[model samples]
Target chain A: MTERGYAMPMRSQDTGRGAAVRSFLSKSPPAAGRSRLPKVLTGIEGFDLITMGGLPAGRPTLVCGGPGCGKTLFAMTCLVNGASQYGEPGVFMTFEENAEEVAANVASLGFDIAGLVAAKKLAVDYVRVERSEIEESGDYDLEGLFVRLDYAIKSIGAKRVVLDTLEALFSGLGNTAILRAELRRLFAWLKVRGVTAIITGERGDGALTRHGLEEYVSDCVILLDVVAHEQVVTRRLRVVKYRGSAHGTNEYPFLIDDQGISVLPITSAGLGHEIDEGIVSSGVPGLDAMLGHNGFYRGSSVLFSGGAGTGKTTFAGIFADAAARRGERCLYFAFEESPQQIVRNLRSTGIDLQPHIDAGLLRFEASRPSTYGYEMHLARMNRDIDAFDPEVVVVDPLSAFRGTPTEIHNTLMRMVDLLKARGVTALFTRLISTQELHSGTDQGISSLIDIWIVLTDLEIAGERTRGVHLVKARGMNHSSQVRQYQLWDGGIRVIAGAFSGHRKPSAAPVLIASGKPAAKPKKSAKKSRR
Target chain B: MNQSLDNDGAKPAGTAAHPRTHYNLRLYVAGQTAKSMAAIANLKALCEQHLVDQYSIEVIDLRENPQLAAGDQILAVPTLVRHLPPPLKRIIGDLSDSEKVLVGLDIRERAPS
Candidate 1:
């Protein structure tokens, strides 16, 4: 018997495409004579949103992760939440910990486990796999387990299923061979009966699932990891594989709290937001004059594309502070630094988000984009936008949204549409490659927006100079010449093009150490080399 | 809560005591094939062997006063109620299983409780 766990070959390598076709067919509405099929939501926040109405109705998905990274907790939370939140009853089968202990452990997390069970919204059966309990008797099958599950499901007519760490079947059962075969049969049985299932596995090094059941069941596979680097402990999720849909490969940071997990995406922070028409300064009077009679549309998207360290974030901080000074709300989602670090950096540029934070006018959200799936990141931003409700939404650099084009396009398009509809003046600073700018083509976003500002760093004859120029302003006439912009204590100062040495600066350089000349990002360099 | 029986105390009731006295039970109905007709026939068959009242029967046609079926548990057209003893035992169904109806209502052969 082949011991490969979850050994289903990738669809790309499948023989007749029969299974995919059949799976697709099965997903359509059942025959007209059939009654409605029940699908229970998986309680993980935003999970339902991404799967676009939750895991495909009744199919089983494997949530695999290393121990202590909250593997079982993830599965348990789904069952507990399903019953409590959605009124969809569920049954949890544990092959690892005993029932009482599992319940107690989760109780600390504030999940009303006992109440749920007493209400009969949930059923927990711990399959005892202890060493001395069973005799390795005759051709025994998992018929008993299935029978118990069937009875429990019928008792309350449960619609959700969770099998926690089925690894115990390796030892508790009479034979591994029978268990494996039965496992496949069990998934088939669940499909026929239509119960949305979540089966968990311990994280394994090289396989999709622990103990190798990865290929057998599960339409999706998610991984959770606790990354402790430099004393920062963060829990992040990466959609290792979502078989049927497009998912983000990046691991996104998430917070586990009394209300469960909340994933944060900073760029999506100010979306779905409404902005006040109230006037605020851009910290630059001349540029403001060149922009409309006021400064940049009150709630329009402003992009400042410049080469490295050209004060992109610094300029945004000043605008953010300007809004704060006027008592207008501003939310700065710094993808690269913590709010404190941002405040410290901003103070040097002459604006502070802290006092406003104290006054409750300005807020900051920061996270590495690599920590979560793209959609999750975007969804988290939408959530934050609702909570913050900022009039001025500033994303330090929009280039991060640029790395993954399809998602970036979708995410940005939705974001732009939302910002415009809400009338929240939005600011996005993008670092364009020198090549993209010099070649006389707008960086991708030029077509998607109403205003574009080209910020440049002129490094000539050894001196580094910076300039900001407005290329286009939608529905408004704006500055058309290259001008000098400086980050001073408390704000940015803008003047006609600098009167210093000129290197004829191009796009921004990728952040590098030593503050020495930063190397162009390899991707950009490759394009230039080509 | 009695230790001797599960809830509802499964007990046999309405058995015949006098061998000479036949319980003379009549299950009134319009005719056979109707639910009431079946109930009447089923009751008579059930009592024949089990009850000391190896009863006789009479059929009453109530398709005219269907109103009377409601007073009884006659939601269905056919219903069988043991009318011999003071209290009645009702069973609904075609006279499919004679023994089940008798056992269910505890129509026992004459035996003291």
Candidate 2:
């Protein structure tokens, strides 16, 4: 009673009394012909984007998932985020865990639940329904729960509510008919109360919830899945149904870590990014010479495909270094090599990536492709991209994604889309087996990129020479002839051969001998004849 | 509101029917609807048949005392809570299922010796 009395004017003060009266005046459900419902943003990453704004305000959103799939955490984060970020008061009523347990669990995520509770911004109430505690002897209804919930809500003037796992009612009260009827009433009552709520339920064998709570909460339903693909677990979220709004219907990958749940909703922001016509170099000495001497278009996707030891990594390193040298941030994702290994290997070519790293303009994220599922890698990449906000992103050797070709393509497409929307130039290096080079299909991502630079080895007289060929550069005049290049102490340089001349020199052997050796070849042949 | 049915105001304080014979029953209803009326009538008839003239029924309407619902842990409408006869018992429904209600309230059998 004391807490309830104390909370009466706090919510009014927070939202202002005048606004409350106006909201109460128009509290009826929208007209039948209305298609869109007002939404409340939870501020969860990618969630608002996928839902096309957020959850329908003043309505319940049912979140269903299997065990340990972050149902409770998702609901808690919504409340926490709503209260802290959106300035909306919330109440978390747990039928399963107590308030302290919920608070302690999310403490690592930097959510000060206790502080919010004390500030009257949030109210966490644990509704216990023990089978051994109460007896039902006559015709009765669950007026008790309604009263408690109402009290909690009014005390904090909460605009948001979370019922973490409503399955406890079924187990605790063993009367399905009564509980079912009461739950329906509770949902209706919550709607009447005009609070945006989240009701989490456990996944059933066939339906969304074991108790079929979906029947009662039909406004919005979101399903979470923890899919284990090849021993790597990936969490995916899909909006099953949003009653009156157009939402993203794809299964978006979400990550739950120290920052809580972050969903990677691809393209929900749409592809209408403002394009920049600026051009940036590829970091190679003569590589820009092929593209009408004007580097690549800014924010465009570039692909570097080549066989092993064809200096594809060297090309990616040079691009990243060049970007960093120009005072632009570069994020290099190395799947096959460690950061130290990339630094050491690129140093031998005299590209010197260490200064960029020291200047805080260059960041190298190295990991093994087998470390997690492909979706998990994409989720992590999305997170890192958002945090780093780099202007140029390089994924060295895109072939390292060990998933199926379709999965790799989808992931790369999503990655490029996100980067393009953010106006970040992307460079991907793909490894192609020597046998796959002649089949005319250059790695699987050639069609998805704006620029394709193919690197191959030309085996001439028992010597393998590296050749750089600009197969396609969209919207620019590009050379069609292969230019043989050699990696030296400084960098990859175009040899002073006949084909090195731009504009497709009259078809030659496309081979260049290393310096001083090919110059004295005739003299050596004469000596042998003597 | 909160009232007892067919009782003439307050009775004598010590008018215990016969110790265990006095049945103190509380029926929680949301309002005076058809279902609530049916539950009230059915409970009175069953009490008359079993504990005749010894039972007292109290009706608490949620419209009047919404806060009281939490005390008895009432989740379903038209719930009957047997307060007297030592151990408490609860039967939920409109009281249409007479046999189930009797079995649930342990009224089909005599009190334990």
Candidate 3:
């Protein structure tokens, strides 16, 4: 299998196609003898992977969705990408919005439709079909539309075409029989022209398209859906049917941002990440010693879960600071507080992150979880990671996100998988309620985590002391003893002994180098081990 | 016949007194098909019956000039567009029903004698 991983011939050899192909082909069994259809890659992120290659070549694909579900944007992205990235000129025939409206709508996405038009790489023809303006008298055919489309295609030598919402014709023309026959002919005509076309339709009540366009364009059907859960809107794409190819049947979450549409095919990453043998420190030397392996495995994911104010952020900040101290790039994603707040709060605990940030070794991204949906957050994070290429990533307090348990778990799992695949170490902090801490429910992402640390605020003899417990560390004989730790202006000091009982006084601390003991040791333990 | 003569007499006097409303019509067709020919003939007959010498028809074949179809936003073949009217109107199909075409173009018809 390892040999086959490298020996497999890649179906898409286009430059800048990115990891979608590599990750997809890594898990799928090789096609032995079956012939695969030729495809035109739509340069949208992760869309190609779900379709295996792309929309079937020289076939019309039906894209049906409800209002504001990004059906038109999806079609326009394909057309623009085909023209710009793939060097294939395209024609956009809009039956609803005019040419200027169509161009203006996608302008924010940075699609230079006007420039492409000026360069003769794209042609946009708006077909206005107003029922009020049109009066039907006798027999007529839709040959004029064909002529216009042909002219546009011939003028640019287009290989891609888009008819955005062909259902508008059904309302314009009352003769359903003639309209249906003409549409069937138009689809067949498009196929014969050898242009990969996208025909968008309004979603029907029960069917795929309002006008039943799925009946004519049977080659491929893609459904775009927008669902709102807890007032957070998420757009999803599903390959409803693909005639000649196997496609992902899952409803992959997609995002429409400034750069355009990007679908996150999270499950396609599978569990085939390469493991690293090296270990990274847990920031606090005492915590690293507690893990027995001296640290977490490189490229592994660590979860720090505890109730609110259990010093979860402090632990994450220390790990990030440690990573930056070693001259490694670290990205700190702060969800609960601002970057300045985190830096100032950590500064009070003797962790100065300003220097690392100034030295460009550390970067901070702070955004409230409600600013976007879960999928958008993932998409933005994916973009940031790609741009920064950090070695260590810190997502402080994943619990700030408001979603169902499964949503949070799935997002974290994907994030971990993404980091692992890139060989980047990730640390996530989650806030667990008091009940959940005793119940042992840690957001259900523990299986994906390589190391789990539970922080607790223990009241020992009327003294509220912080305790650090290593719940599980994969492939390591970690200490199971819950050790008490104290936070001081100097730094965190993991006292050199287990909390044997609630009444026991503090044990002596083995101070870190270049550190002073902020508190006097109540009693010295002779069993102190480094 | 008497009502038509009365309207024609009134039209010539109105034409002499002020500028006549010359009907400017354009018939869009593709490849001179049977429907296209029928539409052209029906449009000419309607113009002869309604406006005699006060109308002019320009037939544009999309097969010869497909680019022109986009200028007028034409999608269906055998379409008649009234260009000279204050409010432009479009009627698609072969123009078989003169009554619907007259109503669509807002043309006032003379009552039968």
- DockQ by candidate, in order: 0.01, 0.26, 0.79
Q: Model 1, residue A217: displacement in angstroms?
A: 4.9
Tens digit of per-residue lDDT, candidate 2, span A1-530: 12122111112122322232223223212211144679887667667766766789999999999999989898988898889878899999888877889899999877899999999999887876676544444345676677668877887799999998778888877677777888998999999999999999999999999989999999999999999978989999999999988777999999887656778776453467678889987766457666664579999999988988999898899889879878998888888887778889988987788888777788776777887787777876776666566899999878888777788888888888878877889999988876887786554677779899888876765667677778788887877767777676566665434343333323222332344222233233223323
Poorest stretch of ten by lDDT in candidate 2 chain A? A1-10
Q: After superposition, how far is residue A416 of candidate 1 from its true place, in Å?
A: 7.3
* Candidate 2 local lDDT, residue A157: 91
Candidate 3's C-alpha runs over 4 A off are A1-35, A355-361, A373-376, A489-491, A501-530, B1-19, B109-113
Better of 1 and 3 by TM-score: 3
Off by over 4 Å in 2: A1-36, A267-274, A496-530, B1-113
Top of the candidates by TM-score: 3
Lowest lDDT sum, 10 consecutive residues, model 1 chain A, at A1-10
Query: Each model's C-alpha lDDT?
Result: 0.59, 0.75, 0.80
Candidate 1 residues A1-530, lDDT tens each? Answer: 11111112221222221232222223222211121323344545444433333455677778877777787777777777778766778888887777788888888667777788898999887765543333232132354456556666876779888888787777654457867887888888887878878888877778766678787775777778787643446777776766565434566566554435644323322334454555445645545655654577677788878877888888788778778877887767666656677778877865656777777777766666565444544545544454455778887766764345665766666667556654678888777777878975454667767678787877666766677777898776665666655565535545433334454334322122213211222223223222
Residue-level lDDT of model 3, residues A156-239, one tens digit each, is 999999999899999999899999999999999999999999999999999999889999999899999998877778899999
Q: What TM-score fits each model? A: 0.52, 0.76, 0.86
Candidate 3 chain A has its poorest 10 consecutive residues by lDDT at A521-530
